[model samples]
Target: MHMVIYALVEASTKDEALAAGKTVFDRLVGTDAHSCAVFDYYVTFEEEDTSVAGKARWGDLPTAVPVDSDDGEELLDRGWEATKEEFERNLERVREALDEFSNEEIMRDEDLARHAFHQVGAYDGPMVFLYTEHASGIRHRGQLDRILEESENPWIVPADVHF
Candidate 1:
């Protein structure tokens, strides 16, 4: 089974964020390691309100996406169309749920951890939250910390990573 790990990568632009994410991924999982890649990367601009709103909007979307198996078979039993329709119908509710949280609450590691499938690093605000696919646990966090520390840019980017 595939597992996900999250990190806060400091970078100015989305391209820089993605590049940092790739570096982190390669360091943690290694170039010749198991099947792994940067699953998602988000870059937040300087404005706090804008960043929070953007994050809230992103938080409103559904996590599951339609996918096909290696044999060209549909994996989702309900099929993509039905699932998408359901997602669209429930978007308002999702937004409402997100609306309940304050900006500070939304960026809290404790709150974020509550929704994650695995352990995650701390988030401050308006930085890249890099999601990657790899085998990792609590211990991997130390390695991540080291990697971030060694870099010239600030280490931690604060944002929620939804599974």
Candidate 2:
């Protein structure tokens, strides 16, 4: 499954978006940010924010961006920053985990584990205005509303268009 999200997170400063990304990533991957296998689905904006907006085929992903599974992103990101051998080991574990979770039911909207405002990109305030080939989770605005419920953030309540 694939997803697009608009989130208001506590990330007013640079790199703060990583925090928001971690929360969303954890929900989708079913892993925590501090785990040994976390992934970042977001793409960097070249000296800007990160957005988690894309489809992840099992084997098409790069070693830099690991696929879902709770803390895989955490592990992968750190390992990618660490020595080569450690990075390879972490990447191996993440691939194995993604294979295991691919066949399972997704964590669902109820799995919103972070405090932020989230919504599907098609939302046009009370209705879906547009949509794309992003996973078929668009017709469920009610579910999106629940997941994107208001969550106040002081530092930065960053927003995403389709991330």
Candidate 3:
């Protein structure tokens, strides 16, 4: 998800860039206030290197969607629904924005001039951070742990199960 977002916004315009950032924030808030609550927003830079060679290429920034939970069951259904929508909508929007940028006459720094007229596989800029998505639903895993610690339910911890 991080790689895709960065790649999609590799050489985007000002207005489009702001829109992309806002979309990420909206998704995070809607998903789990706990996780999105930790992040600031999608980080990006207007003036950057669009080169395609070197170890510091733009696609290497942090992309984890940070999340925390005090009560998992409280947001189970709502969190799942929002998470799904975030992934789908953002993916499509990013692709569309990149495609639109590809048509413009983009100019880059001297080091990146060689590839200015072409669409390389990934970003060669200074920064390219993408949004994060929750892997395990917000509180489910922790709920499992809490059940293990607070309950004597045999099914929660199988008799034959060993870690």
Prediction RMSDs, each to the true structure: 18.2, 17.9, 20.2
Measured against the true structure, the TM-scores of the candidates, in listed sequence, are 0.24, 0.25, 0.23
lDDT of 1 by residue, 4-88 (tens): 2233345555456445544555544335356443323332322245444324444322122111222112212222233334334
Predicted candidate 1, C-alpha RMSD? 18.2
Off by over 4 Å in 3: 1-74, 103-163
Better of 1 and 3 by lDDT: 1
Task: List runs of model 1 lying over 4 Å from the truth.
Answer: 32-163
Model 3 residue 118 CA deviation (Å) reads: 21
Lowest summed lDDT window (length 10), candidate 2: 113-122
What TM-score should be assigned to candidate 3? Answer: 0.23
In angstroms, the error of model 3 at 3 is 25
Rank by lDDT (best first)? 1, 2, 3
lDDT of each: 0.34, 0.30, 0.30
Which pairs in model 1 have colliding backbones? Answer: 123-158, 124-158
The number of clashing residue pairs in model 1 is 2
